[model samples]
Target chain A: MHLAEGVLPVEWAAVWFAPAAATTVIGVRKLRSKTTQIPQRKALTGIMGASVFAISLMPIPVPVAGSVSHPCGTPLAAIVLGPFVSVVVAAVSLLFQALFFAHGGLSTWGANIVSEGVAGSLVGAGVFLGSRRLGLSLFASGFLAGFIGDLSVYAVTALELSLGLFGVSELGRQWVSLFGAFLPVQGPLALGRRCSPVGS
Target chain B: MSLRRIATVLVFVAVVAAAVTPTALHRGKGAGDYVGIDESIMEARAQEAGREARPPFINTDQGDLLLFVFTVGGLLAGGALGYLGRMVFVEGATSRERTRSMVDGR
Candidate 1:
């Protein structure tokens, strides 16, 4: 789920934006360096970008949480692409969602990117690589990556929201409350993401 | 069993589990609820600080119009990003070969 516009204080929003911008630039450079080596990198990035856009739009209701959230396809994208490229894809998709669908917010774009793009992709990639190093099959590794990646996004998002809303003093308590609320739906969604063909 | 087969079975089971879950049970606060929470908190904070909450820059009420603009904008942006990325990154022999093929009109 995306944090809406005007939800965060201007300073907090700017804080998130700076890092997102830095990481995006880094990702772009990485992509440029890899393009010559990978034959279908461009096509794959485009396809994954579009897929991230579409998949994020499909909201699945989580019965126990009394809430609905969509699966973040970033982990799968990170697996196919790399973490940097996945960030680009996520930024593009989240931008569209914020602008066109009102699903996310313009001011909150940086925060969303940090949570869904950078953190999600990096965590997913790290987990995937770690799993592979453990001699796990590709499918199993991908599953773990997708599952962890999906959950991490929400976890980070919870922290961001709590920080913005409650400030530093009550940050921990607020984050835990919000994160707990998200778990019921996020858990099942993570599992579904892990098991999906794209995730594996 | 092959890893692929195991993955497929896992996927099937997950799908079934998701399908069987009742929508009513999941019918709690949506993301919008969080936004509301932020608004209230910010307002309280503003009151404590003796300041006003910052307003949004854009007209958030124009949902439909924004969606249309964003859709068109997103597609163009994504396409342009992809194209530019290809130009900058995909160079050297493969690019030369593709260019030669096109130039030959074959």
Candidate 2:
């Protein structure tokens, strides 16, 4: 769900930027406070950041979509670190990808972060916490968190594209199409992600 | 075990099998079948919306650059994980031991 450069209009990009920046600031502060409380978490955070970076960069093939797609590793990070800190991890990873690999664009960085970082982390963590509260075991909760959160990233990206690029009149149809484009490819990858949180 | 636990295990195994079975069953398929959807689908849709992907500030799409970047990223990730493995894993175990000792003393 890395929206490439020039994909989202300037106004829409800035609209996404506000929340992304806000979350990032809060995430950084939360991470710093946590590190002060538990020094070991600082190193763990770095390792998780690097893991998210490398894991998302790998493109896996899906015969159903007849194409390859990457898995969002934010869920695992969120599961390990807190969700807010996971946002920072994702932002760092997305920024690196944008700068070095040209995978995502600087212009669309806000949108990408909003989709992958904010949406993925919060939803993944929320689902995991919710499942646990409902008395589910660790493994089951992790699997639900990873799978559902992974799918939600694409869903938000599709919504962003529909709102920014396409006409409102055709919004529903375009959103579904864009979301569907990723569904088949992402489903199996999401299944794969189910193991990431628990096995890590 | 309860039927629910057994079912969960079965589903987990099935998912794992589903992920791996395809590659094992269809070895040596055409390379075009594996093109990334980011390029094939996302980019195409963006074009249809009248927006084109511009060249990035540092375009690693050039020869060998992306590969080099991936190699560096992999090394950094591996090194960071290796260096912190003891702190993250061993420390957790040590903490667990400390808690167990405290509880036993109590």
Top-scoring candidate (DockQ):
2
Could you give the CAPRI-style class of model 1? incorrect
Model 1 agreement with the true structure over A39-139: per-residue lDDT tens digits: 56776677777778767766665544444577888888888889988998899888877765666688889999999998889999999999799777787
Chain A TM-score across all models, in listed order: 0.95, 0.95
- Native contacts kept (model 2): 0.56
lDDT of 2 by residue, A1-200 (tens): 88888888899888999989999999999999999998988988988898888888888776654568888888788989988899899999999999998788999999999888999999999989998897778888888788878888888989888988886788999998887666666767788666553321
TM agreement with the true structure for every prediction = 0.70, 0.86
Q: What is the RMSD of candidate 2? A: 4.1
Model 1 C-alpha lDDT per residue in residues B1-106, reported as the tens digit of each score:
9886786678656644643353334455444332332233324443454444444345443747766765675666567656745654565446788999999997
Which runs in model 2 stand beyond 4 Å of their true positions?
Answer: A196-200, B1-32, B91-106
